[model samples]
Target: MDAILRAAGEVLGTELSEPVDLGGSPRTVVLRCRTASGGSVVVKKYGTEPDDLRAFTAEAAGLSLRLAGPELLGVDDSIPLLVMEDLGSAPTLADVLLGNDPQAALDGLSAWARGLGRLAVASVHRRADLAALSAGYGMGVPSWDEEPWLLRHAAEFPAALAGIGVEAPPELAGELERIAATGANEYLAFTPGDTCPDNNLLTPDGLRLIDFESACYLPVFMTAAYCRMPFATCWCVFTLPAGLAEKIEETYRTEVVEAYPQLVEDEIWQPGIRRAVALWTVYLTTNLIPRMAKDEPAHRTRRPVPTLRQLLRHRWETASTLEEFPAFAETMRLLLRDVAGDWDVPPLPGYPAFGDFG
Candidate 1:
C-alpha cells in the first residue's frame, strides 16, 4: 500500500495523505487520497490474480476514453493503478430511489440519461478506441449472433417457464429471434456494461459513470431497453414508475438527436429505440426466469436486494408496463398466474414511494 501510494504521488507530483477504502470486489481495491495541495484523487488497485489483472487493465483503458469516464490523472499500466479526478460524495440514483426526494430523483434520472446519450454519441465513431480497450479481454462489441448472454439466456425461454407452470407461446420464440437479429445489425454504440444507479453518480457538473471494469461497445438500443426495464443487469431491481420511465426515455431520445442530428434523417432514432425495448425485454425476461424460479435476486452483485416476493412483484409490475409487446405481456401474465401464490407476500419493507417518484 505504501509503495503504491508513493508511486501514485510521484506520478501526481504531490504528497498523499492516508487513503480511504471504498468497497469493491475482493480482487480490487478502491481508495480516495487527499493531496498535499488539498485536492483529492481516486485510486484503484488490482489484485495479483489473472482475471483481476485483465479487468484492471481493461478498466484503465476504459477510463481513458474521454467522454465515458472521469479525468485520468495518472496510470501505471503494469501494476494497473489509476489515479482519477474525484467525483465527490454525491448521492447515486440508488440513494435517491431509497430517499424521500422525488424531484431530486427525477433530476438525477434525467442527468443520467443525458450523460449516457452524450457518451454514446461521442463514441459512435470511436470503435477503434473501444476495441483497443477490449483487446484480449473479450469484452468488446458483441454481434446479435455472438452475444453470449442473450444467446445463453434466451434459449431457456418458454421451456424454463414451464417448470413454473407458465407455457410461453410458439410465436414468442420467433419474436425473440427477430429482435435479436435486428439488434445485431443496428444502432451500435459504446456501453459501460454496468448501468446501475450507484455506478452513475450525480456529480455537480453532471452525471458521471464509474467502474468500467466491464465496459464494451454494444447496440445503443440495448442500453435504452435495459434502462427501460427494472435495470435488469444491475442488483437494484425495482420498477421505475410509468410516468418516470416515459420521461427518462424521452430525455434519452432527445439527447440522442441533440448529440447526433444525422441519426434523425437516417431513420435510426425512435423506431430503433422501440425495437431495442421489445428485444431487450425478451432478453431480460429470459435471464430473470431462473432467478425468479429459485426465488432469488437475479444477480447478487450488490447488497440490500428485494425479497423473493418483492422481486417477483417488481418483475410482474415492470413486465406489465410492456403492453406494447404483446408477447412479453402474455408471458408475464402466465408467470403471474402460475406464481401468484408463491409471491403472495407483501413487498419488501421500506420499498420507497415510487408512486410519487414522477
Candidate 2:
C-alpha cells in the first residue's frame, strides 16, 4: 500500500494518506492525498484488465465533458485512476434507498433519471466515441433476447414451480418465446448497463451517477429494462412501498421520452417493462434457488413444514405481490402463459447471446 501510494504521489506530485476500501466486486482502493501545498484529493485504483482501462478512460472522458461526475485526476500506464471531488456530505443512493423516507427515494430516482437523460443526450452526438466505449465495455451487437438464460429459466420452470410448490403450467413457455421473438431491430441507444442503486450517489448538486465501467451503447429499451430490475425486486419483496415503484417507473419513462420522443410508444414501454420483469425474475430465481435448496431444512425448522403443494401455493402468492404494479403484473401473466405454451423464442435486440447460465 505504501509503495503504491509513493508511486501515486510521484506521479501526481502529492503525498498520500491512508487508503480506504470502497467495497466493490473487484475491490477498489481509494486513497486520500494532500499536495505539498495541502490541497486534498481522492485517488481511485481499480482492479481490472488492461482492456477495461479503455472503458475507464472513455468514461472519464465522457464525464469530463458533462462535468456531471467526479473529475479525472490521472492514470498510471493502463491503470486508470480518478481524482474526484471529495463528496463527504452526500449519501449513496443505496443509503437513501435503505432509509424510511419514501419521498427521498422518489426524489433520488428522479434525479437519477435526469442525470441519465443528460448522459444519453450528451452521448448522442459522440457516435464513434460511444461505440468505442461500448466495445471496450464488452457490449457487442447480437441478439440477447433468446439467450440461454431465457432457455434455462424456461426449461427449469417445472423444477422451479415444483420447488415453490406451484404447478408448472405448460402453456406459459410458448408465450415467453413469442414475447422474446417479437422485438428485433429496435433502435439502440447509450445505456448505463449497471443501474444498481450503489452506482448512484445523492449529492447536494443532485443524483450523481458513478461507476461507468459497464456503460455502453445498447437498445434504448434495454436501458429501461436494466433500470427496472432493482425497482421491481424491491417492490415485489416488500422492501419498497407499492406506489413508489410506479413513481420510479413514471419518472424514468418520462425523462427518457422527454429526451427521445421516439420511445413514447406503448409497444416500447410495455416490452421494455416486460423484459425487465422477466429478466429480474430469472435473476432472482437463479440466485435464490440454490440458497433455498440448501437452507430449506433450517427454513422449515423455523417455520411449519407446509406440503410441497402448500409451498408452491405460497410461492405464487408471494409472486403475485410483484403483480401490484399493473405493467409488471401483466408481464408476469404473459411470461407465465408463455411458459405454459412451449413457445419458440427469438433473440433480444442489441445484446450478444452469452451462453453461460450460472
Pick the TM-score winner.
1
Q: Compared with the true structure, what per-residue lDDT tens digits does model 2 show for residues 1-358?
A: 6766776676676677656544433445666665566566666666566435544554554444443466656556344455665555477665555555656766776777667665665555555665443344332222122134445554565466566454534555565554443443344445445656656788777777766554555445545654444332221111234454556566666766755686778866775666545545654554455554332321222121222222222233334445424443453454345432232322111101111111
Per-residue lDDT tens digits of candidate 1, residues 67-142?
Answer: 6677888877666677888889887888777677778877777888878888888877877875655553332334
Per-prediction TM-score, please? 0.75, 0.63
Poorly placed runs, candidate 1 (over 4 Å):
1-17, 35-38, 47-54, 76-81, 136-148, 156-175, 237-242, 258-305, 320-331, 347-358
RMSD of each: 4.7, 10.5
Model 1 TM-score, all chains together: 0.75
Name the runs in model 2 displaced over 4 angstroms.
48-68, 133-187, 226-229, 232-238, 283-358
Q: Give the least accurate 10-residue stretch of model 1, judged by summed lDDT.
A: 137-146
lDDT leader: 1
lDDT of each: 0.68, 0.50
Give me the displacement of residue 245 in model 2, in angstroms.
1.5
